[model samples]
Each structure stands twice: as C-alpha cells, then as structure tokens.
Target chain A: MNKMQQRLLHPSKATRQDRFGKTISLICIGFIMILTVSIIGFIAIHGLATFFENHVSVMQFIFSSNWNPGQLGKNGQPQVGAFAMIVASFAVTLLAAILATPFAIAVALYMTELAPKRGAKMLQPVIELLVGIPSVVYGFIGLVVIVPAIRSVFGGTGFGILAGSIVLFVMILPTITSLTIDSLQQVPDHYRKASLALGATKWQTIYKVILRAALPGILTAIVFGMARAFGEALAVQMVIGNAALTPTSLTSPTATLTSQLTSQMGDTIMGTLPNNALWSLALVLLIMSVIFNLLIKVVGKRGEMKK
Target chain B: MTTNETVITTKDVRLYYGEHEALHGINLDFQKSQITALIGPSGCGKSTYLRCLNRMNDLIHDVTITGSFKIDGHDIYRPQQDVVSLRKKVGMVFQQPNPFPFSVYDNVAYGLRVQGIKDKKIISQKVEESLKQAAVWDEVKDDLTKNALSFSGGQQQRICIARLLAVKPDVILLDEPTSALDPISSAKIEEMLLQIKDQYTIIIVTHSMQQASRISDKTAFMLNGDLVEYGDTKKIFLNPEQEATSDYLNGKFG
Candidate 1:
C-alpha cells in the first residue's frame, strides 16, 4: 500500500474531533498555568516592596510585634512588622484543628464503616450542608451565640482568641469529615473481610486494617481542613475582636493578618507603606496555603511508595 | 467409602439475598484433615457456600440463610453460636492478598493480638512459626519490619495464609487463593497445601479443575448451587456418575 492509502485508512484513529478536543484541553490547562504564575508573581513583587522600597529591615519585620500602619516607628519609619498577627493566625488554626479532628474522625467512621447503607446515604447530604453555610452566617452565630457563651462560662471579655478558634473549629468540621469519609470509603472491602475472617471483630478490623489503609487520605483531609481554617477571615475577624496587640491568654483579644488587612485596606491609600504591608500579609497567607496543599501531594506519594 | 471423619456437615442449605435465592438445598459432608476442592464455573455459588461455612456472608446486608451447618456436630446456624468464636475455629484466605498496611511481623501477629494476647515475646515466636509453616520465613526473616504490600504478589499471598495459620484454626476456607497468582506461585501454593493437609481441614473453591485434581483428596462439583457429584478425587475426574461433571472436566463448556 502507498503511504497516502495507509494514512487514509486510519483517519478515525485521530479524527478531527479528537484533535480539537486535545487542543481545547491543552489551551485550558495553559490558561490556568499562566493565571496562577502571574497572580503569584504580582503578589510576590508588591508584597516585597514594603520591605525593599521603604527601608524596613527583614529581621525587624519578622521579630518585632508592633503593627501600627498609621504610626511611624523609631527614626520616622512606618511600623510594619506583623509578628503578632502571624502568631494569632497559627495559634487559632492549631486550636481549631485540635478541636475538630476527633469529631470529624468519629463522624467519618460512623458514616463509612458503622452506619447502615441507608442511614449513611441519608446522613451524608445533611452533614455536608454545614459546608454550604456562608462564612458570614457563621460569623453571625459566633457573634450572637458562641462569643456570649464563652464570656459567661470562662469569664472572658466575650470577644477573644478562643471565640475565633471556636468559630474556625465549627467551620472546618464538615470539610474534614466529608473528605475523611471519602478516604475511608476508598479502602477495598477485601481488607475488611480478610481481617474479619481471621476472627477479628468489626471494631478491630476498622482500627487495625481499614483505618491504617485510609490514614494517608485522612491526613490529606486534615491538611486541607487546616488550610481552610487558616485562610478563613470573615468569621474569625468578627469574633477575634480585631485587636493588634499580642494575646496573653485565650480570653485576650487578638488580630490575624486577614483581619488586619480587611480592617485597614479600604482606608489606606495605594502606594503607601500601609497598603504595601497589607499586600505582604496576603503574600504570607498565599505561601502558607500553597505549602499546606503541596504537603498533601508529598504525603500521597510517600504512601504509594510504602505500598 | 465413608470411613473418614466429617469435619463440616451441611444439610438442605438454602441462602437468600433479600428476596432472590442464590443457593438451593446444598447437602454435603467435608472430610476432616484433608483438602476438599469445590470446582465449578463462575456464579455457581461455590464461593457463596464457602463463605457460608464461617458466616462471612453475614457482612452483606439482607442475606438470610436457613440450614443446618455444623462443625464437629455443633450447629453453626444457631443464634446462640457466637459468630466471632465460629470464625476463630474456621479461618479464611481470600483470592487477593490483603495484608494490613503494616509490617510483615504485624500482619502475622494480627490474629493472636485479636485474641488479646499481650506478650510480645510469644507473638514474635508464633509469627516466626506461622511464617515458617507457610514456607515464607526464609525470604522474609531479615525484613519483618518491611511492609507486607512491599513484597511480591506470591509472597503477599503466602503472608496472608501465614496470617490465617497463626490463629491455629481447625479449618481454613480459601476462595481461589491462587487465582490471582502466576503459574509458579500457584504451583507453590498447591505444593504447600499438599504438605499441610494432614493437620488442617481445608475447603477451597477453585475454577481450575487441574488444581482440584492436583491438591484435593475429595472433590465436590457444583453447578448453579446444586452439588452434582461428591466423591474421591480420582473417581470424580475419571468416572463421574453425572454427565454434567464429565462434560465440565472435558472442557465441553463451563
């Protein structure tokens, strides 16, 4: 056969629709890559400008606690260190993780392993509705119910770090639980049967076999939930009192980087040191989110390697 | 012909899934301390019957069983018979190797620990003994800390068998234990079964007729939940009284 004949014979192998579909998908992927790179580049450049152009020392910015964007520091420099806000962000997110993990795991286990199929199917959508609630709605609840309750019980000033952490805890609970259930469900049935057939009870099979297999996925869920809690601003801000000072106790008011940015960004003029410092805060948050997400991929790879 | 002791006895066994009946009136006696191979085509209820022996079918929902199943004259279908203790006496291995996501030592030790054995030294000894009996101790002795899944497919399957052996059950039911393995691995398993048949009553559900002839002392042929023939391995393969059994062995059709 001639080359032309051979080529004509296999037209359906890579048809016009196939090529078109491939081209369109490649273009979509390229668009997303370009968007991500440009946005990250913009944040990096604008965020670093606060330190480079305004003559703020990197070490001073990292270690110093003062964050008064309106006031000048010693030698007539704008006070731009965000040490207190960073600590508050981490502390509140850690507290939320500690509060949410046990409940999420319990719910996930009940849904995936213990509950009847009909019950699990019914409970899944209802529990997932918690994630659909708006952050503003959660903020309102924290403002109206949780903050006051904390004040009455713990003798606090009502608006405090504890309030913020509690609100974040509620916000991340559904995210972790739903993802954990999915991960647990991904474990093959044969492992459970193998354990059970060996005379191990159902609870034993869950902890020793099913849970061990689903651990990487559970860790990924937690990392994603923690990232969401760390990035949450609106709800945490409403209950965290928006204070800029360092918190001495759980009852003491505090400020996160997001809360500070939201409060000061509207009034601060562009190209000023205050606006630049706000950009720096966004930069830090962006980096942390990316790192947390990357950690999931690393964990998945290690899990596969072990297997 | 019936001089050997019976380890498992089932009469008028009927299994149902919700409303549909899958197995209908299976009656047979499995021989004690010997390999009994149940051979037939797919969807023939061989595996379902195997699972029924140890109540593994209870894991599925809406499964109702009515029959008299007994091991050493103890009625297994009775409500008072605890499923956990029943399973302890009759262990099982699956078609696929399903070791827990733990080290090799832990996989072998899982059964004893389930029985609440707390002594680490005793667990270590039994783990070694079970691995040796399964003929995998030499290959894994230096690497007991390695994950069981990190081993080859055949090694993983042997480890699963070793896990079952560690429990020291009176009976072991295998659901096509070598179907997922290569030819060499399948032969290894067949040879291992030959060596261990004197101590454990093993009931295996197999698709390959040759494997049944190679390892089993007694053969039970099933066709869509009906036992067509049950006799010595040599008699069933060479002079089956039923036409369907001979047809299946000759490969006329599954």
Candidate 2:
C-alpha cells in the first residue's frame, strides 16, 4: 500500500482524539452505572436482611402498624410493620399532586397561551426561582406559617398529613408548572393555527384542541411532580409530625416512610433489625421512584405514537 | 364573470409586519362559487392576502392592516364583527395537511362540536357527507376511530378539507394547499376543488402555473406584493397583457 493509503488507514491525531473523547465519556457513564447499581444492590441486601435474616414475616412488615423494630411482639416477631408509613406517604403524595395539578396547568397555560410575553419576562424566572429555593426553606415556611394556620382553622395539632401535603404542594407546584410549560410549548404551532382557522374561539381552541393533544405530556408532568412529592424527605419530615402511628384524620400526627428513615437511621445500630427495617423503607421508596420513571417513559412513548 | 355576485371584496388592503410592508394596496374581489387562483413568486404576499380575508392575520403580533375586507356584504374588519363567526363563514385549508392528532371522526366533528351541536346523529351525518365531498370517505370510512395522523399525506390533506367542509362555510381559502403534495395528490386536490367550486367560493394560492391554468376560472398574477394582472385564466395563459407576466410565464425570472 502507498504511504498515503497507509496514513489514511492508520489513526490520525484527530482520530486518536476522537477515540480518547469516546473512552472518557464511556468511562464516565460506566462510573455512573456502577454507582447506581451498587447503591441499589447495597440497599436491597440490607433491606431484605430484616425479613430473611431477622425472621420477620413479610406480611407483618407490610400490613402491621406496630413499628417497634428493636423489640419483639407477643408473636415473637420483630414489631416492624410499616403499613401506616406507606399509607401516609401515598396519601400525602397523591393529595399534594391533586392540589398542585390544576394550579400548575393554569399557570402554564397563561405563560404559553394567554400572556406569553409577560409570562416569559415576568413569570418564568419566578417559577424557576421557586424551583431553585432549598427544600429546607419550604420546610421552615411550612413549620411556621401553614402549621399555625391549620391549627387555628381546623382546630387540631396541624402537624399531620395535611401539613405535609400543603408543603409538598408548594414544593412540587414549580416542578409541575415548569414541566407542564415545557409540554405545552412542545405542542406544534400549527395545531393552534388549525384550530383558530376553524373559527373556534380562543378558549375552545385552548381547551378542546391544545389541551387534548398535550394530555399525555401533561400527565407525564404530573407524574414527575408526584414522584418528587413521593421522594421528598426534609420538607415532609419537618411538617409530618413523625409519630409512626396510623393517621385517622388529616390533622392527626403521622409519619411517612422517608420521615421515619431520616429520623431513625442514625439511632439504630448497624446490622441490627432496626437498621435493616429502615433499609426496607428505603427499598420501598427506591421501587416507587423506579415505577414513577417507568410511568414517565410509558406516557412519553404513547405521546410519540399519537404523532 | 363581472356580473356574478361577489362573495368576498377587498379594496386598498395594505398590511405591515412590524416595520416591513408585506402587502401594498391589494384590490381584488372573488366571485361567488368560482375558483380564483392567486399566482405569485415566493414571498409576494399571496398567503398574506388570503389570511386577511378570514382575519387569520390577527393571530400574529405587530401586524397592522388597513383598508376594507367585506365578506357577503358585511365588513369583516369592523370592531364589533365577531371574528369567530366570520371565520366559521369562511374556512381555510393550510399548505401543510394539519389534522389534529385525533381520531378521524373527532377531527371531522370538531367544527360542529365547537358550534355546540350535540346531536350524535347530525354530527355523524355531516361528518360522512363532508368526507365524501372531499373524496376521501371511501378510503377512511371503516376506520373513523383511527388517528388522523396515521394516514398518508394525500389522505390527511383530504381529511383536513373534509374537516373544513363539515362547517359548511361559504368561502374556502386555500393557501398553497397542494405545494407540499405529490403530483398525484395535487391532481386529486385539483379534481376535488373543481367538484366543490359550484357550492363554495374558492380562492387558492398556487406556485404551479399549470395548476392555475387547469383549475382556476380566473387567475391573478402578483409581483412583489402588487397585483400585476387579473383576467380570465384562458386569456392570461394564452395572451398576457404585461411584460412581467409574460416573462414570468415564459420562465424569464421568478
């Protein structure tokens, strides 16, 4: 082969650089994957230890509200049932998502359709700022304002699922609104034009056409918000009044899985049943988040199929 | 042709997009139940003039329009004029086939539903009639529940036309509707337009001179936002009055 052909076939400096860049990115991705797998694996091993090694019944761990993991019950089983915390977590997450969805959709519509200029210049930054605010600040606000407000109005202790839901509603509102804005913006400009050219009123166009087309995207946004609400720890921990008891009313004291994990993780000894029980709670949270992610993917896929 | 009752009349219609003037004093009238073609080079404001007829330009920002646009002897630009009802009276089919990402049945019934017609029997009847009129009912009749976006481009365009026809508009403005389609699909659209021209006043913007000569009864040649020549399609295609029009037809310059 000629020297020119040899040089062309061999790796040049640019080709070498490209290989190096690819290797670097591959290494970074490998590191992230390893970290994610190890963390999940570690949590799963410890989480399962509570049931397998400690001889706790899986049914009792899930359905029983008796959560004294350090002690044994009359049945000689570890009292580590987490049914109350599970219920509390789902209740707060669902209520917060329901409360925030309408408000988020409304704000998103105003930003994208009604007053786009003012919405972009004035409201977008504000919503982004809300997102950037630390979760601790939200918790602090809830502890002082919402808890006291609920106390006066509803006439109870005010630190309960209701308080957590209200705080979560505020925290997830910006997330849902910003994501909803993105989905609404993803709707093609031609759709709006088509509806208007049909002689439909502005309200009808937005309501019937735009919203229906963006339905899957909007549902995905709400699921994302729900995921954030489900996994949030500190803000919900502060206001949920961590009692480890099954809540009978919105105003009664309750504890979520995350709150219990945060409050008790430090106190339990490593390798003990108490600590392993906390791991089980963590496992539940991890699984729920994975489900949320899967939900987003399914919704996104359905939206694409419609196109 | 001149004695026929006019469905749409525009006098001295000038449009500005921000600081840029797009349409300069366009004076034209479309005859009732006749096909009038607007032929021009790219960006000569044919689509802009078409949009003005239905007040579709109001959706754009920083657009200033002056002069009069009257449809069926009613001033459409009047402040108290209901733009929605005006648009209902004059429907539009766009350059791109834009059916809502919905079932065929829903897409065709959208206009009637918007008009607050709730009777299922009437909506189904209108949907079928319009789809047949647009010459696509035979292809899509069994699959009305299927998504409209799943169809081929030609079929989608026909469905869009069907969607427009369901409203029973008096005037139909087509803005280069066939410019994006294949020759076969374009032929189908031309045939469909000829079939429906007797019932609706049809104004079309076309880049294809052959299409203009083939389907249009009257053709208006526009150059740089000015109406250069307006006459019978046969006369315009056979013997032109203006040098620019002759040059454009003879492929001298766009």
The number of the candidate with the highest lDDT is 2
Candidate 2 lDDT, B1-254, residue by residue in tens: 45678888899989999989888898999998789999989999999999999999998899999989888888999999999999999999999999999999999999999999999999999999999999999999999999999999999999999999999999999999988899998999999999999899999999999999999999999988899999899999899999999999988887
Clashes of each: 0, 0
- Compute the TM-score of each model's chain A versus the native chain A and list the values: 0.93, 0.98
Q: Considering every candidate listed, which one attains the maximal TM-score?
A: 2
User: Candidate 1 residues B78-124, lDDT tens each?
Assistant: 87999988999999989988888789999999999999999999999
* Candidate 1 chain A lowest-lDDT run of ten: A298-307
Among incorrect, acceptable, medium and high, the docking class of model 1 is medium
lDDT of 2 by residue, A1-307 (tens): 6999999889999999999999999999999999999999999999999989998888998899999998888988779999999999999999999999999999999999999999888988889898999999999999999999999999889999999999999999998998899989999999898888899999999999999999999999999999999999999999999999999999998999999999998999999999999999999999999999999999999999997
Q: Residue A26 in model 1: shift from native, Å?
A: 3.6
Q: Deviation in angstroms for B104 in model 1? A: 1.7
Name the lDDT value of residue A155 in candidate 2.
86
Off by over 4 Å in 1: A1-20, A74-77, B1-4
TM-score of each: 0.95, 0.98
